[model samples]
Target: MADWLSPAEWDALRLSLRVSFWATLVSLPFGLLVAHALARWRFPGHGLLNGLVHLPLVLPPVVTGYLLLLTFGRRGWVGQWLDQWFGIVFAFRWTGAVLAAAIMAFPLMVRAIRLSVEAVDPRLEQAAGTLGASGPWVWATVTLPLILPGVIAGAVLAFAKAMGEFGATITFVSNIPGQTQTLPSAIYSFLQVPGGEAPAARLVVISVVVAMSALVASEWLARRAMRRVQGR
Candidate 1:
């Protein structure tokens, strides 16, 4: 393992983990909200909103990156305001890499959660409401419990996607070592250099292992949650 993974590879692995963890954590609540809305709501522009939420899945990563750059780059409207008002910057930074990854992975997360939410029996939610539970209480005690498995699956899917993200991250955040350089970016950089193929191969192995582990853990969590919901 030591021979396979050099110091740079190790750094890339750690950075990738950090980025994916943050991306998944930060996106979870938003994914849940969107999923709930799509699953239950019937308002004007609902179709439009649903389409927009899933557009990332259909769009090219490079196009998504370019759009993010246009909306959140240093000179762009939102980025400029964030820099000036909050002293926060995303362009070409590790945080920006996280944002890009989150955006790219969001559709997958939303789709999974939405499907789960839709699968939940609305009759149970109505029954909870009739039993004197408020809207928030019904959602908290009834809807959410039924969809726990989906939430876990979605979070893991987003995490894995973020771990392997490349085009959007690189286009939005550039490849700065020890900064925005993730595992995939590191691998790409290694492949571009002479005498770097072996290290790149090692990183690839690490990436695959990490991804597989995440998926297995997600499956386990999903099954556990499903069993609990069934017991309920």
Candidate 2:
């Protein structure tokens, strides 16, 4: 199977995996935090924060990419400051692709975790607190364990989304081969050229396989988490 794919195609596949992994890894913690806040805390601007979290699901990917470019591009305000102070840049780089993928996938991850968090019994947490467990201990031992399944599911969802992300990625990074070109971008590139259908079709198959595997893994993880909670 590896022999059948051209080096360029292989690069795209590997790059996609790399980008998706980083996106999921970086976003998981933040996603859990946001989901926990939304599910457990009632604060000012809660609705606004929730809306912002899910905005990408409703907004066009192109628009999100454009906004990221404006905020994080080399000459953009934040981008300029970042470049001047920290020498970090997001425009047209694989790191930029990771950022785009993370943003696009964030809502799905948050939603999954949020639902799972909401399903957990608050009474269990309260009991733990009454037993002299501190806030952090109750959260770490009781709350976190119950919601592990959701977190795993959310991470998987985010990973799958990052793997398939195209519009925001392309818009922000311009699809530079071996740099910012991910699986979806590679597939788009392949389809744009004459006699490119074969490669495109192969990529499509690869995408499907990856997506299905992630879904299956997510289910398995979720079930395992549930079993652990039940056993405890």
Candidate 3:
């Protein structure tokens, strides 16, 4: 496979993997927090919060990418401030691709974990609390353990989503080779030229393989987590 694929293809594949990994890892904590709050809390504007969290799912990918560009572009408000204060930039860069992928995948991650949290028995957590465990402790020992499988599922889903992310990533990062060009972007690039079908097909295959592998791994991990939680 190494000999079959050009260095550019390898770079795209590696960049895709890196972007997906970072996107999932960076968003996991936020996803967990949002899922827990949505499942357990009754704060004001709960419906609005839920809708906002899921807005990306319903929004057009191009629109999401545009919104991201406006918010995180070098000359944009938030982007300008971050760049000036923290030297952070997300425009036309690999980091921008990560941000785009994470945003695109966020809704799926939250939804999966939220559904899992909702399915858990609240009394189990309440009992832990009544035993003098603090909120954080109860969540750590009981709530999190019960939701481990869900967390795994959510992360895997997000990773897969990130891997296939194209529209938003291209819009936000402009698909620079060896930098921001990810697998989907690479495939799209290859398809634009004459005689590019073969390379594009190769990338499509890699995408499929990666996605399937992630799903299988998620299932295995979830099952193992459940067994451990069940003390079997």
Flag clash pairs in model 2: none
* Reference-based TM-score of each model: 0.96, 0.97, 0.96
How far off is residue 54 in model 2, in Å? 0.6
Tens-digit per-residue lDDT, 75-146, candidate 2: 999999999999999999999999999999999999999999999999999999999999999989999998
TM-score of 1: 0.96
lDDT over C-alpha atoms for residue 192 of model 2: 95
**Ten-residue segment with the worst summed lDDT in candidate 1?**
1-10
Ranking by TM-score: 2, 3, 1
Q: What is the C-alpha lDDT of each candidate?
A: 0.92, 0.95, 0.93
lDDT of 1 by residue, 1-232 (tens): 5656777778888888899999999999999999988988898989998999888788898998899898899998999999999999999888998899999899999999999999998999999999999999998999899999999999999999999999999989988888889999999999999999888888888889989998999999999999999995
Candidate scoring better on lDDT of 2 and 3: 2
Worst 10 residues of 2 by lDDT: 223-232
TM-score for model 3? Answer: 0.96
lDDT of 3 by residue, 121-193 (tens): 9899889989999989998999899899899989999999999999899988898999999999999999999
Q: Which window of 10 residues has the lowest lDDT sum in candidate 3?
A: 222-231
Instruction: Show model 3 residue runs off by greater than 4 Å.
Output: none
